[model samples]
Target: MSYDKTIAQAARTELERRRSQAQETARLNLEGFLSRCPRAVEIRRELSSNASEAARAVVSGGEVRMELEQRKARGLALREEYDRLLKSQGLTRRDIEPQYTCPKCRDTGFVEGRMCDCHRALRRSIAYRQLSTGLPLESCTFESFSLDYYRDDPAAMKQMGIIFRTCREYAENFRPNSANLLFWGATGLGKTHLSLAIANAAIEKGFGVVYGSAQKYASAFEKERFSREAGEGTAGDLKNCDLLILDDLGTEFPSAYSNAGIYDVVNDRLMSGRPTIISTNLALDGLEKRYSERFASRIVGGYAMLGFKGRDVRVQKLNR
Candidate 1:
């Protein structure tokens, strides 16, 4: 459940921002309250002094019982006066206090030296948001995916219905070590939509998901290869994310380095038992020819193949 350092840092920044906002708001509230009710200032000062006098009486170690009782009564009277002033001004103690987003952590993202649930949720949200950039995650949901596109052909419709159900179930039951999936078919057959739907579900369940076109990853891989640094970079994230959705797999600019990079990513994820969903327009044979028999074989042996059917869905939409 490790997160990217950048994402962790962003979450920390967000928590600090919330904390600062709460404190600043409380400061302004107190300033305004004191301005409106000037008497509250003297009451607050006396309340502070009364508490200090009680502490001093305790430490004096003499027969200070009478003095302590007197201080306690005075403190109570001061508090009552303060409350009356607040009531007159239509304010409460909370109105002058910091209203932290997470009262448990006081917006600090931690409690008693352990990370808080709110912090973990923030990190997951930030990770999902960063990974889902450039994706139509909001629109490509299972609810929005229509089976009507395949209605013209009963066989296509039936198969697509099953595919849709399977995809929905897969997403609902998705885990970090769930089985791999390969979506193979012609363009505009809803492969990308279903894969993104799975990604959205996984993200909602607090799993880190990395999703992008193959070309986007390929270009990143190529760029990282030529860089001076010798770190995993994009390959690490692709292989290590809780779920990886590689879309349009055969559309990348093919080169020796990019091809090998792609193979390494696919192979490494497979070897590590990490779940991946790859959507490709290439057929099994085309995949073998484009990459290598080894790459295609890895997919064949380790992945559940879902063949998308129907005419181009984009064309169908345009016609309708």
Candidate 2:
């Protein structure tokens, strides 16, 4: 499934820019080396001329084998002499050669016209950014999460403590399609914080993680009804991402269309063995009522529901 076109384009453009940068640096280095070692430069020209002459002899049905052997010996001698000169000047052959970031692909972001792993990794990061465009990511990491806010309530404090540790662990070990999570609780319980923390982890691991509130996603999906390219069909992006975190599931402007859309997404991801983290204020029965039993049933069977039990920490923070 395709993500937002702009994001994909940005990733491609960035990778291309990196590749171009590598190529330019290599070219400049080669030019400098050739200028520094005129003898090595002459050797390269002779090697090229020998290759051309050998090709002509082969096509003309002459004894190309003897010519190829002589050229190979002459080229090896040139290479050895060049190396000796470099060593005498406190340099090495490596210093004079074009240095590539990925020698297999020559920093071209591809090999044999197929996408390189580095390019795919770039796309994954861009995909994550596309989904979390509006998220306050830096502010919601494990470090930023404050247990001081819930200190007044012993139960809340304990729950928050455990939640923090769990989230930290989750983030530390997160992999692609690792585990499904359900963040079920009332509002103001830091569901979004933990969700973003997980996203931070997945991003660190080079996995494409899509994170957004259900309200925002629902609106984007609806807007796509009018414009096909409205925000990368956020649903498709969610469906295909390495990890999906949908926050405030029941808080979206509920409608038949939205409900069906949510069900379709949740079900499809589950069927494909993709990991999705759904944070909802609604309880289990509420989920059953809002969507069909099928959606809830899928969650029951597939997801690891993490029940968040804590009073409103935001209120405690304000009072303190």
Candidate 3:
């Protein structure tokens, strides 16, 4: 999949950070060990020089073997002296070598020039974090949702309570192949909150989540529509994210271009069997009027619908 350049760069930056950390640890430990065993200073310098000489000796034919033998003899003698010296000081040979966090990859986040699994996972996590920045995510968790705001009306309370529970369960068990969901309700009724809660959960599971309000999507679509070849396109990523949460549908300025673009993104995801959670104030018929009959069908066809019926939580909370 094509990720944003910033995503790939962030991944590389993270790998570099890990590598630097590993190197720093090695340097710090080496420095500490050298401070304890002053004789290791000589052996370290000699070994470093031998490493360079070993490369040069590769071109010296049989003389390389003779040089290698001499280096080996000297190394053995140094090791013996160091051991005896450490015995007196109470330390081992390993106590003087550079220590690594990962012996297999050495905290490089790669092997054979290919990215490691840890690196890929980190990139996906970073991407989700990047996308969700400044989004109102914390207010929407199931724990924050309350049914008291629905009113004492038994039917409304029961319906809203069930809806709230269903949304909570859905978000709790969310996965890439999880079922699509529609959150239909009036504004301030917790639609965005629940969708964001699910997004938070999905991201916690290491899934890549894409979230944008209808206004944001429409604005981007309009910009992309006008500048077809002028800039990068993010539409594909929107349609292909592991979980897509499109909030505040029906709020964007209506336009032919944005209308089609919106349909394409939602429809493509639906057809591809990718999970999407759309929170719209528009009811089924209103959805048909603003979008299309086919689009409305796509939402209700196989996807589950959660109807939010509570009064404005913001208003009720403020009053309380």
Instruction: Tell me, by TM-score, which candidate is best.
Output: 1
lDDT of 3 by residue, 1-320 (tens): 23456777887787677767767765666576678778877876887787777777887666878888887777778778767876676656555443444455655767789767777777778877786678866666778767777776788788887877787788788777889888898888878777887887877777778888888888888877766653447677788778888888898999888888888988888788889888888999999999889888887796788877757778877888
Report the lDDT tens digits of candidate 2 across residue range 71-119: 7788788778877866766676565455666777766778899988877
Error of 2 at 90 (Å): 13
- TM-score, candidate 1, is 0.91
Q: By lDDT, rank the candidates, best first.
A: 1, 2, 3
Q: Relative to the unseen true structure, what is the C-alpha lDDT of residue 254 in candidate 3, on a scale of 0 to 100?
A: 94
RMSD of 3: 5.1
For all predicted structures, in order, the TM-scores are: 0.91, 0.74, 0.78
What lDDT does each candidate get? 0.90, 0.78, 0.77
Q: Candidate 3 versus the native: TM-score?
A: 0.78
Q: List the residue pairs that clash in candidate 1.
A: none
* Candidate closest to the true structure, highest lDDT: 1
lDDT of 2: 0.78
Clashes of each: 0, 0, 0
Model 1 C-alpha RMSD vs. true structure (Å) is: 2.5
257-294 per-residue lDDT for model 1 (tens digits): 88998999999999999999999999999999999999
- Of the two candidates 1 and 3, the one with more favorable TM-score, higher being better, is 1
